[model samples]
Target: MNRLQLAKRLAAMSVVLPAAASFIWEELLWLHALALLWLAGAAICWIGIERKHHSGQMRRTIHTLQAASNRTLNHHRHDWMNDLQVLYGYIRMQKPDKMVECVEKIKDRMAEESRIAKLGEPALIHYIQSFRTLTNAVQLRVEIAEGVHLTELPVDSSGISESLIEIMNAYRFAAAPALGEPAVLTMKLSMDDHALYAAFYYQGELTSEQRFASKINQQLEGAPLRPVEAGQPYGNMLLRAEWRA
Candidate 1:
């Protein structure tokens, strides 16, 4: 039951209470029974409110986490695609030195992003690692700090991943036909004792600013389940969500 339900029940009970008290055989018994009923109602109301609040918060938190995960996946996929393209060109041109250099650099970058593995969430990690076939022609790069670990992540991380996916997809879809290729979004993941952090840097130009902004606001729905910031060069975004250990 929610707050409205509890309120409705209380209203109904309030009407019944007067009739109930009047029918009691003794005044003392009526007084005691009425007091108990009122107390019960109040307790129910409080519980309803608390539950409702908790449920909403949980939903938002999960969604935010999921968005992060999805964006990370997409970014990884973008980078992997670039590597494949470079390899294809190198193999065709027979440029051994260039191929080796690029391959080594990619390896280094992958190692840096691998720090997210310490977050202790397999589903999210796997999903992020397999980012490909995104809704838009966007590039994503995920980087994680060294020696950073988030020991106790929630069992389900799809919510935040989904949030990120939604944002990107919406932005790309809203871009006009003339807008052409999507921008690159660099995602960096980190965490402290209290929160998980996701910092985004976008490096693409949108044809229609108003349309993109409108789509983004609609996608986010203005609910910061976690603290977030957005502004500056190319409108980068940040999310800092508390994590409980």
Candidate 2:
């Protein structure tokens, strides 16, 4: 079940807990204690579910990183040497313009890679990378605004991680291409005015866009990951996840 449904059930149990004690008389007093214990168990169960989710994210993050590295090595076994050799050839051929363009692109890519490490927020960095392996058709694109350097957020992130995961999963499911065209999913992370910001956008098919958006917004109800603006941009969807600075 979704977190909201779980929360509603837990709230119901909480309401019933106090009333349960009044119904027990002296002879049945032990039953009241049992009921209290049962309520405590339910609370613990809820907490456990949250912890389990966090653990799952961490595991997925590690797996995704491993898979990404493997894919990179397999795909680019000769890429480094090839690029440099090509650049060297350009120089020998008196192609200064081409050489400058190639070097600029390479530097830009390296800068982006460096930004990921400088993010400093392990969970966010890993989450961004996890998209690499999350789906095949959806090409995940992450843009870190220049000067975006983050420190460790809350241990639990107050649901930022969970909400972003939910949104991403929805987009993943919605990314099935009808015309064999691939989907381009973009996410931007940055900081402004004492708040951290994340915005997601995707161009793809969604079985139910309304349902997808609602599910995402629900997870971002409180604390970290507050929504500044959440809606569809043109044909794409966006959820701006944020936390206090």
Candidate 3:
């Protein structure tokens, strides 16, 4: 349910509440019985409103993550194409020394990208590895805490993997130019009886546009699950889901 639907349910409850309460207090047997029915209806309405709110929050969070992931993927595609063109031009120039240098640079870059791009399910492991690879390329450090498991989480494994890849790609592209030296990207994964969680930390300030896009995407989806706040000198991304075990 959306805000409008929630409001309507609340309004219906408000109207029925007083009528039912008054009839029940008056000790009018038949009227009291009818009031009891109204009260039950009001309770149902309240439950609906609450469920809607929870659902809305979840939806918002999921959408935000998805949009961020798509943007990252698109950015990678653009950069990869541009890089290929440059490599192509270098090859066509027929300058042996420059071609060799260009080939080496392109080869290393492609290799790193491939490592992250190749990640697939099991999503928990893939995300942990991908985050580690991305942050390491930037010279950031990552630590995986104990208890992070992917085995029984209540989320789509493929979707989680895709989202993680997209976010990492976005961070890499955004920070590439600013990287004066190699930086580190760190990740930690843990799980318990009740939940599964993954956390990523990268050095550098995330851009305003990235932050804004994240927020907009979250609101549009209506979910409470938003990215967690990071401390100074680091940016963080947190993904979590309830566990069935």
Candidate 4:
């Protein structure tokens, strides 16, 4: 059974045991004490179980954030190398005009990258600082909506940040190319009613091979990975929240 069901069962036992002890064994004080002790143990166990559940969720959040950060860094390194190569080629050609244009383009790209890198700077940096051992081979692009401020969200900043990271990582993995140049991944976040909405857009063209791998006829209900066709490779992944009455 689920955690909530288990908690409810323990609660019912706790109430029933105390009442039964009082009515069926009035003269047995030791029995009454033992029943109370059992009830107390059950309560403790229920609390521990809840704690563990939350802890596991937090751990998963951290892992997702780490993966996204690594992907972003790798993408940045690849782009930087590509820019340098272009600059080198222009220099060798001895075309002063073209060389100047290449330098200007590289500067503009660096400025944009620096701005994005600053948005999630310290927090994202600290999370992935220890991940110097892994090799990353993907490209990513993070796009923050103009005039959007993540700090204005009503939820805890850390949770919102981690959720963004998770969404980005999911997009990175789903959009990574199996061949040819890596795809571009964009992360956008907005807010409504104390809830944050995130959207990840990946640009690419879906091939016949992807359509065949979908197993459309055999899909289970509520599958985590849903096959979406958006006029070929340009599709988006969205995450949102809803309130219940």
Candidate 5:
């Protein structure tokens, strides 16, 4: 086990040992007071240690998130600058069609991002939007079907959000495409018959297909969503999940 878990176990043992001693030694009944004091001290120390560990974890999480945020901002800035340069070059060349196409691409990207932001879960939205900055293992595209609001659905929003995150993580880490080719995963979220559905279309190779399938199954255990169908069609993996009320 990790050091933190080990330390917690030791602290618990310390508290339990004293109580056990008091209970075992009848003649040391008078020592019950001492044992009680020892237990109390140990419990307080355990609490302090737990709090300190959690505080450190929180700080680390915040720092990592801030770093991710900064990277995302820088990447976006670079992309915008590139787009502007392309637009400027098109203008200089008097290529109106190319310029229009570039502008349309930008607009489409903005519209998709807007829909992602409105997914109704802050963590899900942030994770989806910042996924590219976090990793290049998978080229991820998330599309939310129009008129679907996760928060408005009569289902477990947080659970669904967490499950989707887990599902993405399974694919993200397992992604290992062939030489000179990157893995691509397109996720489409939609609602049907008062139920939420997520469909993942993956185009690439995995280092270990069995391991990836195992990870997906493990994450879905007891989750709010369950797999509807998973298969490989025309050499591509397609996975679909439906929210179970």
Candidate 6:
């Protein structure tokens, strides 16, 4: 441990040991008061130490989040630059067909991003939008049905967001990187008259299929939505879940 931690432990031991001895062999009233004073000092020291540790943790978390945000912004900027370069190249080559295709792709991507932003849960929106910058192990394709807002549902939004993040993490950690290209994970969110549906389609190689399935199941335990089914069809994994209104 660091010197600060070692010192705190030493200080705690000194006060506690003296207090214990005083209680065991005290012959005077003043000795009891001294023991109580030592006990109070120990408590104060413990509270201070805990507060300091928590404050440090909070600062670190903020720093990490800021760094991630900066990275995501850079990635987005780079993507736009590349897109513009491609469009410029197409225009210079006098190829109108490829230029139209590239513009359509950009429009679609922006529309999807706009939908994700209005998902009604800040945490889930951030998680989904920043996921690309978080890792390179998986390519995430999120499809949110038009007019579907998560907050409109009667279920717990936070729980749904947490469960979705955990599910994504399961695939992210289980996918084999060296086997081939990064895996593609598609998440489709749709709503019906009485329920909401989330379907996960994973098309890629996993280090261990059983382990990935186990992790997904474990993460979904006690989640807001119930698992409808998990199966493999055409050598691809499909997991479906639904939340009734």
- Candidate maximizing lDDT: 5
Counted clashes in each candidate structure:
18, 0, 22, 2, 0, 0
Instruction: Predict model 2's lDDT versus the native.
Output: 0.67
The lDDT of each candidate is 0.64, 0.67, 0.56, 0.56, 0.80, 0.79
TM-score for each predicted model, relative to the true structure: 0.46, 0.59, 0.44, 0.46, 0.75, 0.84
The list of candidate 2 runs beyond 4 A from truth reads 1-69, 72-89, 152-162, 178-180, 230-245
Worst 10 residues of 3 by lDDT: 224-233
Q: Write the per-residue lDDT of candidate 3 for residues 1-245, one digit (tens) a residue.
A: 66757685676757566585676579667677776677777777777777877888899999976775666567657867887787788778877787788778778766544443333355434444334334544543344343332333465555555555455565665554444655456655555666556576776644554563454344324332234443223365675655433
Worst ten in a row by lDDT for model 4: 216-225
lDDT of 2 by residue, 84-129 (tens): 8989999999999999998997888678778877767566666665
User: Per TM-score, what order, best first?
Assistant: 6, 5, 2, 1, 4, 3
For candidate 2, the 10 contiguous residues with the lowest summed lDDT are: 234-243
What's the C-alpha lDDT at position 75 in model 6?
83
Judging by lDDT, tell me the better candidate of 3 and 6: 6
Model 6 C-alpha lDDT per residue in residues 1-245, reported as the tens digit of each score:
96557767876887867777787887877878888888788878877887887788899999998998898888889988999999999999999999999999999989998999877998888788788987788899999999767786676777888888888888788877855677898988887766667777888877887887778768877777666654544134343435543
lDDT for 179 (candidate 5): 72
Residue 103 in candidate 2 has what lDDT? 96
lDDT (10s digit) by residue, model 1, range 88-182: 89989999999999899888876765675665556545544544444455555677776445444631245555555566565456444436665
The TM-score of candidate 1 is 0.46
Instruction: State in Å the error of residue 98, model 6.
Output: 4.1
Instruction: Answer with 1 or 6, whichever has the higher TM-score.
Output: 6
Better candidate by lDDT, 3 or 5: 5
Error of 3 at 241 (Å): 23
Model 1, runs deviating above 4 Å: 1-100, 109-132, 147-151, 154-156, 175-182, 218-227, 230-234
lDDT at 115, model 3: 41
